[model samples]
Target: MEVTPRLTWNEEKSLQKLLGNVSLRLLYKSSVHGNSFGTMLNKCSCQGSTILMVYLPNNVFGIFVLESYPEMSEHLKKPTTSFLLSFQKNKIMEMTAAFFNSTVDLIDNKLRFNFSQVQYVLLRSNTQNIFIPRLLGEKLGLTYDFKSQYTEYEVFRVEGMKDEPGYINRIAGATPHRDSLLAELRAYRPYADLVSEIRILLLGPVGSGKSSFFNSVKSIFRGHLTRQAIVGSDISTITEKYRIYSIKDEKDGKSLPFMLCDSMGLNEKDGVGLCVDDIPHILKGCMPDRYQFNQKPITPKHPTFITSPSLNHRIHCVAYVFDINSIDNLSFQMLAKVKQVQKEVLKCGVSQVALLTKVNNCNGVLQDNFLQMSESMIYKSQVRDVNMMLGIPKSNILVVENYASEREMDPLQDILILSALKQMTRAADDFLEDLPLETDAIAGMFQLCMRCQLPGSRHLAQTGIADSLFETLLPFMFCLLSLRASN
Candidate 1:
């Protein structure tokens, strides 16, 4: 049997394309036989895994050996095999020299390749040892050394392996948390690669401008106003459920294949909306009742909503639309609903972005006339009540006016939607990348991080002191709604 000699590192420099991936480098490091090869295996990330070492003359070459056998233990232990297949010093020297030129130190204890860095190195092993030059010689009708130790070597080698998924993570932003929603929210780029679809919910009460705004969003994609109303009447009874809309076209004009769930409008008779109530239908991976804990049902009459903790891991973000036309001052009920939204988000690990709609209709979303009302809502309903009740951040609240004739709702929609989506995508990507693989305490730490950094929390910071105080105070008004529900 003839064994091919290893090529000198410089001899095959032209074959640089062969060592294109990080995995191959690792494989060469693990499977080669030699003391020098054994030393190189220490640089790999596959700690505690048995490694294969090959002996070449100049330096050690080895890759993590994945296969194992009790009978081959002694052979596996020794770098050099003394049998007929023993490596020639010259062949080994050439292989080791190539590796030294290709490998470099990456953070402490980690060795990276000049080409690509791989998480796991896989080696290609074959019993047939063939030399590139001799193979070329045979094709050219040139007689070459068939068995000479100096001239013949088997196996052309290269390092670095390409991991497509790993490449995706590198391009996407890296975050520290484990929850997929948070990860999507945090990543810099849209997760069109990892997740095939995104679920969204458009929420607000009757006359809150939810429909008009929904129509506006649809208009952006179709290049015309919504021809027909998307809202539908309930067949079951007088009670009107909120309508659901799938935001098929992203703000960038990319179309989604399907419409998202839009809730029916809240009946005008009830004088309250079920924005929180419909949350269960908009999200995924949560039991109707619980994520981890039994979720409290949100009655239309009550302004508080609770969800199982696990809901946080599933749903990505919620767009809370409020009417700019209604009550210049924040109403206790409105504050209550906001609090309920905040609480549900926190409980289920969802990110919230607030939208104050209908600015144009009221002479301005914020008219001089509603200043007092806005202040009252800020002080009486929102600040000390709602936010105080649930400890939601004021930054999450956004004030928008869809009715502004001077500035159409399109800009507002673009800003709000883009901001929210950007935040969500960035958050989710970050969480996924740095997320520890360990499922124990590490997962808990990830969950905690998601709560504080979500878009809702970030927005709360932007609401300013007056609005913050208003949100804090509004929860008390819920007492009436809660009491009314019980009655």
Candidate 2:
């Protein structure tokens, strides 16, 4: 018997986002089909790509079975793409096999779904031992002994899941261009003659995937998943120490020509995340590696502070990492803090870019094929908003999906990461090429003095030092310019 789907509009939208706009046809409902184990097996068996939803009094949770259920299988089958999804108070939490292994078993006259150490049995007559994992159970407020009699279970067959070509242009080639991108990055060198390696700093709000970006990049180069930097979704920042990470080539095991500097995340509340005042010191490259970040900003008096850091120690490019999902909900205080930090970064003349992470979480189509990021309207709109908010050029903003739950490397994902890295290298090169030579220092100082005589030089006039300094450096500036002209 056919049953009408009880899913709300928002719930349907969320499902489409996860499953790529597939149509759901209700196959069986326990309430209408007598809640018998044999009945569900008969109706749902051999249904390709089914979603089994268990509706409890206050919560709804389910398992998405990517493969068809066999009629009679004594042994369990491991499904690769299946996942567990739970909806609590309209918020969804999806967990894949990366979190825990999942298997489907139809034995002992019961249909069973096993997730790691926990099992869910779908039989009303028999006593169901629904032992949910403690971590997940606590999060969803579910007891270990959840009864099947108190819930309604429904199964829906997913359709129209055939692979479709991306509507938009692919951003980067998956396999063909992956090798070339790797080669280009391996052969890269700093444009600045003074610096051997370029230092790119990652900064963002808590849980913005700054550490995850570094981990993803390392995973690509290391040929496996690397978690050197700690990552979590806690309210406070997980990274306490400022770390400067270098990726090594897997073949030779030598450090790459660039370093990624990671620091504490920025929080809206005061005395929480990275201090806005400390940004200047960090940009100046005075902060030492592994320097502990407390609530207070670092000062010149700090014991480990480098009073005169060389160009090699300074940041060449700053990538402002932002989660695509949370960009719209950014707090005013956070934006103000970012703008405040950007002022200091501009003063240092470092290149800035915005990294829109977690693109998969925002669009289901992109989740399946990340190459279509430019084509996804949702993705494009988010990029536009980020560009507007940060005042960064649209070209400077890159989209990436970090490795969260996968065990192996994906070439599609690698392409995105490599493309972003390539842009960073280019941006760093621009900053390096534009850097003032030591011989031009006197000319730069002269330019600063000339600016002091402008109409809005009231502040310099108030200090009463601009005129005297200008008079003192006047002859030297001319001498430097004359020497340059003669050369």
Q: State the C-alpha lDDT per candidate.
A: 0.35, 0.71
Q: What is the C-alpha RMSD of each candidate to the true structure, in Å?
A: 24.0, 16.3
Candidate 1 Cα lDDT to native? 0.35
For lDDT, the strongest prediction is 2
The residue-by-residue lDDT of candidate 1 on 264-375, one tens digit each, is: 4433333344535545534532222221111233442432222222223234555555554454455566566656655665665555555555443221122222221244
Candidate achieving the largest TM-score: 2
| TM-score of every candidate | 0.34, 0.57
Relative to the unseen true structure, what is the C-alpha lDDT of residue 303 in candidate 2, on a scale of 0 to 100? 98
Among all windows of 10 consecutive residues in model 1, the one with the lowest summed lDDT is 92-101
